[model samples]
Target: MNILSQVTRIKNAIAEVLTGKDELVELTMIAIVNKGHLLLEDVPGTGKTVLAKSLARLIEGDFKRIQFTPDILPADITGIQFFHPKHQEFEMRPGPVMTNILLADEINRATPRAQSSLLEVMEERQVTIDGETLKLPSPFLVIATQNPIESHGTFPLPEAQLDRFFMKLPSGYPDFHQEKEMLHMYRTKNPQDTLKPVFSLEDILVMQQEVQETRVSDEVENYLLSVVQATRSHEFIENGISPRGTLAFMRAAQGAAYIQGRAFVKPDDVQFVAPYVLAHRLVLTMEGTMRKTKEQVLKEILESINVPVESEAGR
Candidate 1:
């Protein structure tokens, strides 16, 4: 099957369990193709966990969930070394991070020290324990969720850590019709329980390889830089997109194009993914934060910049 067909299959599978979230499903697929982690921030009972679990089930990958808590230790995530009298040697015990799909539920509830442990694994795709490093399975992806409405006993993720996520998304509450549909769908069985894998790990890897090969023309490249540079100079911004953020934006644009069944990146692809890619990376001034959110600032920046015409962007 073609990439678009495969992607559609996976999307439909997840949508069966996660009702009223077509865009969320698409964004999750974009992150998967880009080999990037996602941060789902929303209020409780927004189906964040169900969404992550549904994706895991649809991908046929090994999934693990870590309920992050303030008392959780770094070793609890990266694994540990224990002495085994039977083996007469220290044995390595890998943690949840070793799996292909890791659901870090309530990530912000963990202390910074414990949270930082994920930084290395997320970037390196490997974990070290007892002076030894173990590589994670191919197609590793972290779907971390946090409750934005709660502040009690929660440790906010540092800016540096926030930048690491490719996209920060919200699993908003379902509408009345959708919520009614969900109630009926789950009246007897959990939708997620019946979900079977639609694609294999190798299939995802192939799609990712194709996404990396997706084309970006020079005019589009210049347009991307112009937008990022504008963020740095924007009157209400304190910090702008970094060089790393620029690369991520490019990759995400390519992923968006791939999802649309296009071999080349278009201005619309960049525009569609820009807010999600750039919002979390930005730091607004105190006045700016009080007046507008990062998404609003990013939207203004996007509007201020000129989008390359199709002829130019396709050049």
Candidate 2:
């Protein structure tokens, strides 16, 4: 099947259990193709777990969930080396992170030590235990989530740690119709239980390469830079987009254009993917935080910049 056809199949498979989350599903696929991780913020019972679990099933990847808590230890997640008395030697055991899809449910509930343990694994795709390093399986992606409504007993992720995530999603509440449809669908069965992989890991790797090759013209490049520059100079902003963020911003637009069956990145592609890729990396001033949200400030920044014409972006 072609790339668009494969994307359709994957999205449709997720729709079996989720409703009105097409954008969420689409962005998740983009993240996979671009080799990025997602951090979802929402209250419980809004399909956060279900979405991640369903994607793991649809991709046929090994899925593991770690319900982080205050008492959880770093060794519990990065694995531990224990002496085997029977064999009179030490044994190496891998943790849940060894899987392809890891659901870090309520990630903020864990202590800093436990939370920091994932930083290296997330960035390097490898974990170290007792002076030994173990490379993670292919297509490793972390879909971490935290409850937004509750602050008690939660340690919020710092700016440094937050920057490690490629994109952050609010995972908004479902609309009335979407919620109704979801209720009716789940009344019968958990559709994910019957799900199977629609595409292989190799297929995804190939798609990643194709997406990386998508062209970004000079006009579009300047337009994207203008937006990033605005974030740094905005009156309400304390900190702006970083060099790492700029790279992710460009790559996400490439994936967006590729998904639309285009060989070249357009201003629209950058605009569409900008909020997801840039909002999380922003740091608002104390006054800005009280006056507006990161998304609002990002929206303003986007509005201030002029989008390059198609002829200018690419022909």
Candidate 3:
């Protein structure tokens, strides 16, 4: 099937399990097509773990869940080499990070050392063992979920670690109608039990390539940079988005365009993806943090910035 069809199928399949979260599903798909990882922050029982598993099932990829605890070690995630008595040789065993879809449940619960171990694998897609690097499987995606309400046993994710995630999302509760439908659907069995694969790993790789080829005009590029620049100068923010954040915003826009079945990106594409791509990367001022929400600050930034009008000359 084509890229657009594959995207739609993936979205529909995920929606089957997660009702009334089309926007979140679409952004998750965008992160996949852009070859980026996702960080989901929400309360418990919001289907955060289920969402990650459903996406893994939809693509028919190898899925593994790592429960992050205070006592979890780096070797637990990256595996270890052990000596064999008879052969006088060491054997290497791969950890859950070797899988295609990794569900890092309660990622914040782990120590900084254990959490930092994921940095190389997430960014470089390879694990270093005994000075030798082992390559990970193709289409490697990490969907990490953290509990937003509980900070008792959790260690907050540092800025360096947070930069690895392409977008940070929140899986909120469903509406009354959707909740009613969910109750009706779950009466017999969980929806996840019946969830099936919608696409293959090869199809996703193809979509990723297509997303890279999606047209992004100079005007849109300038507008994206301007928005990032605005964040730095804004009094409400102490630190704005970095250069890496700018690239992420552009790539997300391209992904959004591709999901819309368009080969070229539009200004609306950038607008739709700006908040998710840039919000987490921002460092709010003391006053803003005390009195305003990130969503409110993001809205103010969007409203204050001018959206550049593209000229017909480029078209």
- lDDT string, candidate 1, 1-315, tens digits: 477787788777776776789888888899999999999999888888788777877888888999999999999999999889998998888999998889999999999988989877999999889789899998999989999889999999988999999999988988999889888988998777788888888888988788888999999999999999999999899999999999999999999999879889999999999988999999999999899998888888888888888988873
Candidates' lDDT values, in order? 0.89, 0.89, 0.86
Better of 1 and 3 by TM-score: 1
TM-score of each: 0.97, 0.98, 0.95
Report the poorest 10 consecutive residues by lDDT, candidate 3: 306-315
Give the backbone clash total of model 2: 0
- Per-candidate RMSD vs. true structure? 1.2, 1.1, 1.7
Worst 10 residues of 1 by lDDT: 1-10
Alpha-carbon runs more than 4 Å astray in model 2: none
Across 234-306, the per-residue lDDT of candidate 3 in tens digits comes to 8888888988988899999999989888888888888999888888898889998998877788888888877
lDDT of 1 at 243: 93
Worst 10 residues of 2 by lDDT: 1-10
Q: Over the stretch 244-302, how does candidate 2's per-residue lDDT look in tens digits?
A: 99999999998888877788999988999999999989999999999999999999999
